[model samples]
Target: MNKTENSRRRGDELLESLYNATMKLATTTKLTNLTFQQIADEARTSRTVLYRRWSTPFDLLQDIYSYKAKKLFDGAFFDELKDNGSLRKDLLQLLTVYQKVHTEIGAEIINNYYFLRAQDKNDNNELLIHKQAVEKHLNATKKILANAEKRGEKIRKISPITLMLPYDLIRTENLIRPTNISKKRLTMMVDEILMPVFVG
Candidate 1:
């Protein structure tokens, strides 16, 4: 490979390693206590590498969260979701995939980023990060509802808070139980909770 290509590959590898280390640390360590030194030690890199990029662990995590969240929504699953034939099926499939993605990204990491974001009331950039993530989720939910409308299903004009239900519900659920949230409970979320509010 050319020098430029080799340099790009090396940078990508370092980023992947850093992201992996941060996520792994998130499970056992609180974000409140996370440090550049810990991440460098875990990633087997120097603290200067982290310091050069992020002013704080929260900043680094924001990038990591954005990176991971993009991967979740960029999948073709949602594009084919409208054809699932029923609202309940669509919700179950949606939440199930969300659960899997959150599991893969580390539920603790998801929760920590959100919690820290929520606690920061003065930072415009932090608020922007949260808003951007929320918009992506809301757009996905709106598409599902819009598609259902095309299918002749009754779509309600719910509030923005309600539109955020799918993201919040599964995020909190997966964090609470980690890998232990049963498919049965997932079905109940679709049947007992989501269907009534979104459809009925």
Candidate 2:
């Protein structure tokens, strides 16, 4: 490849590395516990490079979440849903993946972000950006369900609030003490509680 092309690839790789480091820190430590120095060290890049790219830690976090969400949801999850061709099955799969990820790592970052945002009212931008990303994900999921409804398929009507409630509950329970809630149980809950309101 040309020098310019190689340079561009290198820059992209650097950004990816920085983002991965930030996400690792986010999942493993509280937001308040994270430092630019730590991120720089973890990414194998200098603080100057990170600062030039992101003005603040929040900006770095915003980019990290955007990258992680895209990596997690857009590719395999969406593809599997499209291929399944069964609305209920697809929704269940989506929820199952979400539940697993949230319980595993995503929930910690999400909670930490909220906790930090609460401590500083001036730090609304990071929280807003994170909230918007979440809303977009929910809207996309809703659109999928809407399409299924249009196809004459039966699905329970689900408000964004209702959809997120059980997820929050599961995350909280897991955080307190790991639970053995099966995917089947979650699927049943969605079918029984959410479907009734969403479908009719």
Question: CA lDDT, every prediction?
Answer: 0.77, 0.63
In the predicted model 1, the residue pairs found to clash are: none
For each candidate in turn, the TM-score is 0.75, 0.58
Compute the lDDT for candidate 2.
0.63
Across 18-132, the per-residue lDDT of candidate 1 in tens digits comes to 8898988988897889999999878777777788889999888888877776655455445545458877788888898777777786666677767877767876556354556
lDDT of 2 by residue, 72-104 (tens): 433343444452566666666666766666654
User: Candidate 1: TM-score?
Assistant: 0.75
